[model samples]
Target: MRVNFTIEGPPVGKARPRVTRKVTYTPKKTSQYEDLVRYTAINSFDGCFDHDEPVDVRIVAYFPIPKSWSKKRRQLCLINKELPIKRPDIDNVSKIIMDGMNPKMKRNKQLHRMVEVMRGIYHDDKQVTTLVVKKRYAERPRVEVRIKRDMGD
Candidate 1:
């Protein structure tokens, strides 16, 4: 089937902005797996924004799941898995990120806030499949903190 839609723009100055048209086509009975694959490919960039920065740190948390899972399910799994890292009283989000780091390193407020924003993005349980952190090498942040869940027999 073919779908066409128009996006109307807000009025500016004395003239109305022209509307833009979008078109989409889909085949019949496509598997939900196709959506999952597309979602994974699109989101693969989430944790990779700062990868090339020499002074920046990057951490990646990978969950054991295939692309067949929906985006929401993946995010929920990440949130449920990483909930222990959340902080209650910190006004600045970066503090939470630093707090999530290894306690051995002295806490830096900036690092902590970065982690908090990253964590907050994943709180929805629909946007994340894994969480990764990248930081400067000097910080020596902990690479892995496992969250265990028991499946009852």
Candidate 2:
């Protein structure tokens, strides 16, 4: 089976967990990005990969051309003459998306209980055996993800 979805926004990387005196927490940026991904995934698919099934994923992160750059430079970036080699490393970006597609639980401070943040697309990110990630520049920023069951040959 195969699933494809596009997230319309700036692509985000997974930030290292932040540690306070009492708790370790995901950064706000990362959490918010994950939430966006989760919302999109839920709306995009009706089923998910099984626990033992191997999965393959492809992600393409598109960044908007900087306004500070000259028009010519922006055109070059849009045409793939220049790549988005800046912040939010490819690995980090991949990690965020994978994690977002996997189930997550969080403590509900007000309710004093654990609540499901998302009913993910898979049991775990570990099910993914192959991942292809790339970054490019586009007129509008977005992230495109394609996922499929891997039938081992």
Candidate 3:
């Protein structure tokens, strides 16, 4: 899955420059399931500013989930008991994928929805933003799923 983000800013001297960050995930073909994620720092600052000028900088960064690590396979035992896996349900799948692994308070809803769709449990009216598939690891019989998110229009 791929997502693109755009940022706009005025000239550096006249106003504070805007900085945006982007990350991309590229998966490898080997069985290790290795993935390469790239981080890019784009400088929207115009070159008009003088080197000696003291400029106030405010950075706006957008960090997206890595593509390769987005989906992971693990034993179903890792999932929370509250999550429903017996029957195929989008909401349950979403909850399990998004909140099952982490004990954190907040969860990423968009990422959950995306995972649900990828599992063939739900279909979005619009195109799917991202997709992560869940399956058993080669050496283990345990089940696993992938988690990913995209900026939807």
Best by lDDT: 2
- TM-score ranking of the models: 2, 3, 1
Model 2, total clashes: 0
Q: If both were scored by lDDT, which would come out higher, candidate 2 or candidate 3?
A: 2
lDDT-better candidate, 1 vs 3: 1
lDDT of each: 0.27, 0.91, 0.24
Residue pairs whose backbone atoms clash in candidate 2: none
Taking the tens digit of each residue's C-alpha lDDT, what string does model 2 give over 1-153?
A: 888999998888999999999999889989888888988987899987898999999999999888899999998998899999998999999999998898878889999998877689998899999899999999999999999998766
Worst 10 residues of 2 by lDDT: 114-123
Q: Is candidate 1 or candidate 2 better by lDDT?
A: 2
Task: State how far residue 117 of model 1 sits from its true place (Å).
Answer: 24
RMSD (Å) per prediction? 23.2, 2.6, 22.0
**Candidate 1 runs further than 4 Å off:** 1-55, 66-97, 102-153
lDDT for 51 in candidate 2 is 88
Worst 10 residues of 3 by lDDT: 33-42
lDDT of 1 by residue, 1-153 (tens): 111111111100111124447634323212222232223323332332222222222232222433576777656655554222222222222223322221122235866633322221123222223333422111121222221121223
